[model samples]
Target: MGDEVPGVGAHARYVPGRFADQVALVTGGGSGIGAAVARQLAAEGCARVNVADQDMDNAESVAVAMGGTARHVDVADADAVDALVSGVTRDCGRLDVVVHAAGVDDPEAKAQLLSAREAGEPVDVLARLGDERWRRVMSVNLDGTFHVLRAAVRAMRPRGRGAVVTVGSSAAFDTLVGYPHYAASKAGVHALSQAVAKEAIAFGVRVNTVAPGPVDTAMAARTPAAVRAAMEAAGAIGYASAEDLADSICYLASPGAANVVGAVLLSNGGRFTV
Candidate 1:
């Protein structure tokens, strides 16, 4: 893992031109692991990188920094996702890799959990999980991955070679008692990735999922202190940086993972054996 991939990105094993002449698209590239992945792809000499995100400002900033293009896309909108993949393919002439990382946590649910913890109140997490909150999480986290993966697979299948890495969550398997919706959505993403990989592999398109634990991202920053502490205590290496998760993601998207398909690569730094 420490080996250098020079052209791929910083802090990675150096393999000059590992991604040269390739075209890649990273959803949620506005920040966190997605942003790191975009930068890595650019460093690896990808001919074109499309940064798709709901946050226009963040997306633009990352794209400009990496010398890539920014696209304002909400993966929940299947039509919009389709157009994004089509537009990228049309412009780049081919799509070599895709990293679907756009996802959301229910703010209401998180807020309730935090408030309850601070107040020492007994809060029923499930009862507070309203229909709207649950739906929103599912739409953005699960359906969004579906839209991106569907479009990406279609765009790459004809070419007979491509790699797709879906960013999932360790919560999916470990179970986040306070955020069932978030966990369920990510679980769906993992299952979907495997299902798609089963068919996409025949076309030479590999699909995989990366389930990351407590990384230093905005989402994790807002976690309850108690929960964060517990998670860190469980992990052998404590919290991982966004770049650390990006390394795992980029490796899966690289040729180094050509034989890896439908595998959920857990990157929790030895947190929770199960």
Candidate 2:
């Protein structure tokens, strides 16, 4: 089975039927951690999976592979997010789980910092970060999370049962020197998730966050070598794979986490101590 499955490991275990008859929506399902979650949900027999992403090509590919539906949505837009949720609920008759994994980091800012360091100039990220760059990162990582979470919560509230697992960053709690924008945005995400979890759980909806440390992803691949090396060493397990994150995310979205609410599950591989 491992030899036949593209991304599956030789020892990977799947809980077939765990999500059977349930519908799921995964934002940023085109690639990386989101893609991994989408695949896992399908493997577990989710009735309908909505793969929402801005990149339609990648989204469509993953959707096709898992027999899910691909949706084109830029999560930073509230109306788009609302429509995505409504459409899924309207079509599928229910939305049992939502994994909000769409987020962005400031690679350009990291590049500038690295370049300044190489030239022996004092690197002040705040001084160098442009207003537009900072806003863009916040818009995607923080605002996008807000839009998705709000819309999902509303859709699930009426049902009286649902789960939402959002992807956060360990950087939210730690200092990612050159990425103040990224850190700030993710911090907002963590706080927002907890606040909403309190309210949403009252409606029998569960909202939680999975804060990951250094994960080997396409975004990570773009980081400057110096920055990448620091990240690689930051995690005790070197670096986690996107699939590793997916595993944690799926658990948070499953019945196993039924009693868990307003929690931030750190899947950072010992990057930090709570």
Best by TM-score: 2
The parts of candidate 2 lying over 4 Å away from their true place are 1-11
Give residue 186's error in model 1 in angstroms: 0.6
- What would the C-alpha RMSD of candidate 1 be, to one decimal place? 2.6
lDDT of 2: 0.89
Every model's TM-score: 0.93, 0.95
Query: Local distance difference test, per candidate?
Result: 0.87, 0.89
Worst 10-residue lDDT window for candidate 1 reads 1-10
TM-score of 2: 0.95
lDDT of 2 by residue, 1-274 (tens): 2222234333265676778889999999999999999888888778888999999999999998878999999998999999999999999999999999998888788888788778888767788788899889999999999999899989999979999999898998987877788989999999999999999999999999999998888988888888788788877897898889988999999998999999999999998977
> Could you give candidate 1's per-residue lDDT for residues 1-274 as a string of tens digits?
2333332335644345678899999999998889888877787668898999999999999998768999989999999999999999999999999999888887677677777778889766898678998999999999999999999999998889999999999989888668889999999999999999999999999999999988988878777787678778978999998888877998898888888989999999998765
RMSD of each: 2.6, 2.0
